[model samples]
Each structure stands twice: as C-alpha cells, then as structure tokens.
Target chain A: MSALAEILFGGLFQGSLYAMMAVGLALVWTTIGVFNFSHGVFMMLGAYIAWQLVELGLPAAVAFPIAVVVMAGVGWILQASVVRPLIGRPNIVLVVVITTLAAGSLIENGALTIWGPRSKQIPALIDGNTTIGGVGVSLHQIAIIVITPLILAALWMFLNRTRLGLALRAVAQNEDASHLVGLNVTALYGLAFAIAASLAGLAGIFMGGYRFMSPVMGSDPLLKALIVVVFGGISSISGPIFAAYLIGFFEAACSYYFGLYWTPALLFGVLILTLMVRPEGIFASRSRGLA
Target chain B: MNPILTVEGITAGYGRVTVLHDISLEAGRFGNVGLFGPNGHGKTTLLRAISGLLQAKSGRIQFDGQDISGLSARAIVGTGLIHVPQGNRLFPDLSIADCMALGAYSPRARPHEAENREKVVKLFPKLAERWRQRVRTLSGGERQMVSIGTALMSHPRLLILDEPTLGLAPKIKDELCASVMDISRGGVPLIVVEQDIEFLLELTQQLYLVNHGAVATEIKPGESLDHGEIMSMYFGH
Candidate 1:
C-alpha cells in the first residue's frame, strides 16, 4: 500500500512539471502553427538564469520571478525576430522547424560555453521533507503539486475570462478573422510565446530545486513534454494538461514495475498505439479549441 | 457629399496571379453600396483590398480622408471599418458572449462595447438567449447573426459583409434580410457582396457589377432593380 502511494505521489509530482512544459509547446503550436523546438532550451536557460541570480546573492523568490520575466522577454524576441519573419512564407512549417532547432542548438551551446558543464541545483522553496498519506516526499514536491494547479487555473482564467486571453484564443482559432475583428495578431502571437516561455522557466526552477540541472538537462523533460502534447492533442489548452497527469502516473507505474530503462520504450509504445487508434488526439474533438 | 471611402486605380492579387486588376470605386457617406459579379471573379477580392487584408500592388486607398493604403487590416478597423467575412469565421469553441468581447477588442471600439452590444442584441434577439453557447452549436442562420452582430460590436462607421446569407434556409434568409434592412436604417453605410440580387438591390442604393477583376458597370440612381435588365446588363457586357 505504501509503495503504491509513493508511486502515485511521484507520478503526480512528475506530471506537474510535464504539464508546465507541455502547455507552452501546445500554445505556440496552436497559435502560430509552428512547433517551437527551442522550448527546451528556454527551460535550461531559465534555470541557469535563476542559478546565476541566486549566486549573485538575491533571494530565491526574487531570483526565480526575475528569471521567468527574462524568459518572457526572450520568448517575445524569439517570436519577433525568428518566427514573425518566417510567417506568410511558403513552407513556413518546415522552415520554422529548422530555424527553431538551430536556435535551440545555439542557445544550448551558449549555456555550455558560459555556465560550464557541471550540473547545478537551486535552493528549494522549502528545505525539508514531509510525509503525505504514508509516502515520503520533499516539501518542494508538495509545493509543485499545490502550486501548479493554481498557476494552471490562473492560465485557464486568463485564456477564458480576460479580454486579452480571449483575443489570444481568437487568434489561434482564425488568424484572418482575428485580424478582421481588430486584434493585433502579431502582438498576440508574441504574447503566446512569452507566456509559454515563462511557464517553461517556472517549471525549470521547480525541476532545478529538486533535481540537478545542466546545460542539457532540458532534453529528457522536453521529450516527455512533446509526447504528452502529441498524446493529449495540440488543439486545446486543456488537452495536454489532462494528458500530463495520465502520462505521469503511467510513467510512475512503469518505473516501479518495468524499471527505468523500460519506461521510455513503454511510453513510446503507448503513444504509437494511441496514435494508431485515434489519429486526431486522445482528448481533442473538432469543436474543442484553444479559445 | 464627400465619399467615406475611395479606392483609386488599385490593383492587387494573390501571388503572381492578379485577382483584382485596376479596380476603383467610391462609397458615399450616406448610402450603402453593393458589389455583384459571378463567383471567383472579383467581388470578394475587391473587398479584401479595400479592408487592407490585401495590399494593393499599386495605387491608393483613402478612408475618411486619411490615406490608409499603408495601414494593416487591424489598423484599418480602428477607423471603424469592420468586415464580417463569408462563412461566419468565428472561433467554434468560443461562446457567443466571448465572441462579442473579442469583436470589441480595439481601443476605438472598447468604449462603445456596452452600447453597441445592446444594439446587436436588439438586431438578433436569439443571440441574447444563446449567450453562453459556443459558436459551433449555432445554426447556419444563427452563425450569420453572430457574425453580423460581432461586426456591429466594433461600432462600425462603414460595415462590409461578404455573403452574409450564403447557405442559409430561405426562411432564415428572409429573417436576416429584415435585420440587415434595420441595420441600414440605423444610418451606418454598408458594402455588401451577396449572391441574392433582390437582397442586394433592396439594401444598397448604388450598384457596381464587377467582372474579370474590374468594375464592368456602375448603375446610378433612377435605375430600377429589374431582374431582367440587371441580368442582361451584367451578362450582356
């Protein structure tokens, strides 16, 4: 019973991180019609920025938020300079893949060149451990479990309730219609990237507090996030959030039973089977959308 | 009286194939104008050029005396020129209420959102009952109402509608025609492109027959909306 509880707890914690990472990827994809390959690097870069801020003797709270803010700026620039120019060009889908992939590669190398290859950890929001329902878990894990939903709820409200959020969704649904409705489509696209990047940054901080982070630590999480997004459905914002928890639990069960080496294989197999069964998505319907 | 919008010798197209060749027309401040033509000729293309959705490869467009050829579609909308394009191009997942909010997104329109929304609801009373319903659940007629209602939320000085009644039931088309007539009676000028010739004639005072990407004919006042004459005048030339 205790082992089962622990496994479930681990899944929940892991899923929170995946949800944070995947939503950004999904937002950019739905809004701009391009997959941002640099999203992983945004995570690594965010963690590094937080670490540097902490090293410079700032409080973790201040440093963490500052890092997320910086990532937002970086994301805005990425859209303006890289993504915006490529829009309206023929074969933009293929071209964006190459450009963002190259941009991610460059940023990854820049992190390595500047921060060195040594894995580093940031101070956790809480320094102690706690027992929850017969499972031993870090308070940081508890923090993640608790905080992620609030952030997600905030995001949900922003997308559904606020005027700007509604406008962002309008852009996602029909770009030309959005323009006709008087939305600044370019600015909204940039806003989507910025929000996605900031979420990735916060997820990075959460991961860095628990596990060590290096210039390349973003890869594993990135791959998982991509799977979660594809598995859930890229059409609606809620789809990936729902899938992340399912995958998180699935991964936990696999880790406990089949072991670590088998988790990826099992996850990939499940993804393939899911795709074969429902090519549209696990949760998306035609009427469901980001707006 | 001065024209509200003027397009002078504008030529635009998609890519290398020019869809609108040297198309020019003027819209008066007091009366609605209708553009009619065969499918795939240039009626919709001309609307696209006027609204700043397509940049003219050459020539100028002026709206309310502000040379607006350089403005983007969104910027053009700030001047209260709203386009409710064909097919009720609303986000399917968005609720009617949310759609209305997005319709008034610009600074120029936001201030009048409350007042304009009242007028829109008055124009389409069914919309008030279906406020929380997503656009996907709306019927063809209801979607058209939301499309026009959303445009009205922008507080348009001059409204442009492309095929607002296409693919609707005859009953629904009559309902929409009544609402559109009320809209014109409310004093906002309209640029309507519709396949329903009777609807076009009843709604607009000035008529232009667009053919092969140019203004092939312009029927001034004293011209009757005689179906036979219009058919021959448009098809004969």
Candidate 2:
C-alpha cells in the first residue's frame, strides 16, 4: 500500500509537469495551426538558461523567471521573423513545419557548441523530504505538486477572465472571424507563441532542478507533451491536464508492477488505442471541431 | 454629405482568378444597398473585397474619407466596417456570449461593447435565452441571429451581410429582415448580398446587379424591377 501511494504521488507530480509542457503545445497548435517542432528546443533552452544563471550566482527563484522572460522574447521574435511571413501563403503548413524543425536543429546545435555534450545538475530550490502515508516524498516533488495547480489556476483565469486571453481563444476558434471582428490576428499569434514559450520555459526551469539537464533532454518531454495533448483533445485546455495525469499514473503503475522497460510500450499502446477509440481525446467535448 | 464608403474601380480576386473586376459603388450614411444576382456571380466576392478580406489588384476603397484600400481586415473593422460572413462562420464550440464578446475585439468597439450586447440581446431575444449554449447546437435561424448579433456587437458604421437569410424559414427570414431594417434605421448603413428578391426589395432602397465579376446594372429606388428580365439575366437565359 505504501509503495502504491509513493508511485501515485510521483505519478501526479510528473503528470503535472507534463501538463505544463503540453498546454503550451496545445495552445500554439490550436491557435496558430503550427505543430511547432521547435517547442522542445525552447524547453531545452530554458533549462540551459536557468542553469547558466544559477552558475553565475543567481538564486534558482530569480533564474527561473529570467529564463521564462528570455524565452518569451525568443518566442516573439521567432514567430514574427519566421512564422508570420509564411502565414496565408501557399503550402504554409509545409513551410512552417520545415522552418520550425530547422530552427530546432539550429538551437540544439548551438547549445551543443556552447555548453558541450556534458550533462549538468541544477541545484534544488528546496532540500529535505516529507513522509506522507508512510511514503517519503522530496520537497521538490511536493513543490511541483503544489505549484502545478497554482499555475493551472493562473492559466485558467488568464484564458477566461482576461481580455487578451479572450482574444487569443477567439483567434484559436476562427482566425478569419477573429480578423473580421477586428482582432489583430498577427499580434495575437505572436502573443500565443510567447505565452506558449514561457510555459515551456517554466517547465524547463522546474525540471532542471528536478532532474539532470542535458542538451537532448527536451526530446522526451516533447514527445510526452505531444502524446498528452493528442490524448487530451487538442482544442480543450483542461483536456491535456486530465490526459497528462492519466498517462503519468499509468506509466508509474506499469513501471512499479512490471518494469521501466514496459512503461514506454504501455504508454504508446494506450495512446494508439485511445486514438483509435476516441480520436478527439478522452476529455474533449463532443461539440468541439477539429483543433 | 460625403458617402460613408466608396469603392472606385476596385479590382480584386483570389490568386490568378479575378472574382471582381473594376467594381465601383458608394453607400451614403444609413443607406441600405442590396447586391442581387445569381450564385457565383461575384456578389460575395465584392463583399469580401469591401471588408478587406481580399486585396484589391487596383483602384481605391475609401471608408469615411480615409483611403483604406490596402488596410487589413483587422484595420478595416477598426474603421467600423464589420462583415457578417455567409454560412455562419462562427466558432462552433464557443458560447453565444463569447461569440458576441469577440465581436467587440477592436479597441474602437470595446467601449461600446456592453451597450451593443444589450442591443443585440434585445434584437434577438432567442440568442439571449441561449447565451451559454455553444453555437453549433443552435438552429439555422438561431445561428443566423447569432451571426448578425455578433456583428452588431462591434458597433459597426457600415455592416456588410452576405446571405444573412440563407437556409432560414420564411417566418424567421421575415423577422430577420425586419430586424435588419430596424438596424439600418438606427443609423448604420448596410450592404447586403442576398438571394431573396422580395426581402431585398423590401429591405433596401437601391439594388445592384452583378454578373461576370462586374456591376451589370444599378436599379434605382422607386424604379420597378422587371422580375422576368432580372431572372433571365441571373439564369443566363
């Protein structure tokens, strides 16, 4: 029972991180129609930036926000310079996908060149562990568990209650209608990318302390994010959150009972089965059109 | 008085396929004009061009004395020209209230959003009742109401509606036309592209017949429309 409890808690913590990572991809995909193959690179960059800042003597708390801000700026510039030009052009999907993939390669190579291939450890924001129901949990895990809800709540408020967030949602629904209604579509797209990048950056910063950081660490999270978003329903914000938790719990349970090697097979199998059964996602509202 | 909008020899189209050729028209303040023609004769294309969805290959489109030929759809809406597109191009999963709120997205329209919402709700009380409902679930007539109501939320100076009554029952169509006439009477000019000739004649003071991507004729107010002649023209008989 204690072992089960520990796995459940760990799973929840990991799921929340996946939620944070996936939400950005979902937002960008639904709004901008860009799959953003480069999103993982942004996450990697965030981890690196936070790590470098800590190396320069800044505290983890300060380094995290700074990295997020930098990532937001990077997102804005990338969308404006690369993605905006290709919008409304013929074969836009092909162009954007190729451009973003190229950008990801460039970022990865740049990181490799600068930081070398060596892996680095990030100092934890907190030290010590607490016992819950006879299971020991690290302070970092607890922080992640607590912080994820706060972030989700903040994001929910921003999306539903704020004007800019409302505009972003509107654009996501129908770009043409948004423009006819007088929304600055270009600015909204840029804002969406910036927000998405910042969220990914936040996840990266948190994970930097949670686990060892490497130049290629982003690929796994990126794949997990894609899975969560697809399984959750691309159009629904809360859907990915729900799916992330499910995947996280399933993986944890599988790893605990079976083995770590079986976890990937089980996860992918579940994803495939879910896609076949409910392509719109487990949490997706039936009324929502294609994302 | 200067016209609220003027299109002087505007030529526009999709890439390599000219849908409108040298289209010129003008609308006075609070004037209601109807574009009457068969389907695929560029009536919708003309509306799209005026709303800045399609770029003009040549000529000028002036709105309220400002040259707005090259302005984007977003900028055009800022000038108080709102287009309620055909086929109910609404966000299917969004609540009717959210759809209405999004209509007031421009900075210029934001201040008047509440008042406009009130006006729209009053105009279409059905929409008010289903404010929380997703647009996809609404009936055709209800969706049309939402589309028009959404456009009204923008506080438009010139409202362009494309086939607003399409796929609606006769009774609902009559009510919608009445509401549209009410809207026009409330000091907003309208350029409507509709297939219902009786509704068009009842609602508009002037009509333009477009054919082969050009303005073929203008039927002035008080002139009798030769129904057979118009039918033959539309059917290419």
**Model 1 share of native interface contacts:** 0.83
Interface RMSD of 2: 1.5
The most accurate candidate by lDDT is 1
Docking class for model 1 is: high
Q: Each candidate: what lDDT?
A: 0.90, 0.85
Poorly placed runs, candidate 2 (over 4 Å): A286-291
Q: Scoring each candidate complex against the real one, what DockQ results?
A: 0.84, 0.72
Clash pairs, model 1 backbone:
none
Query: Which tens-of-lDDT digit does each residue in B157-205 have in candidate 2?
Result: 8899999999888998888889999998888888889898887877787
Report the error of model 1 at residue A73, Å.
Answer: 0.6
What are the per-residue Cα lDDT tens digits for candidate 1 across A67-138?
999999999998898899999999998999899888889989999999999999999988899787788889
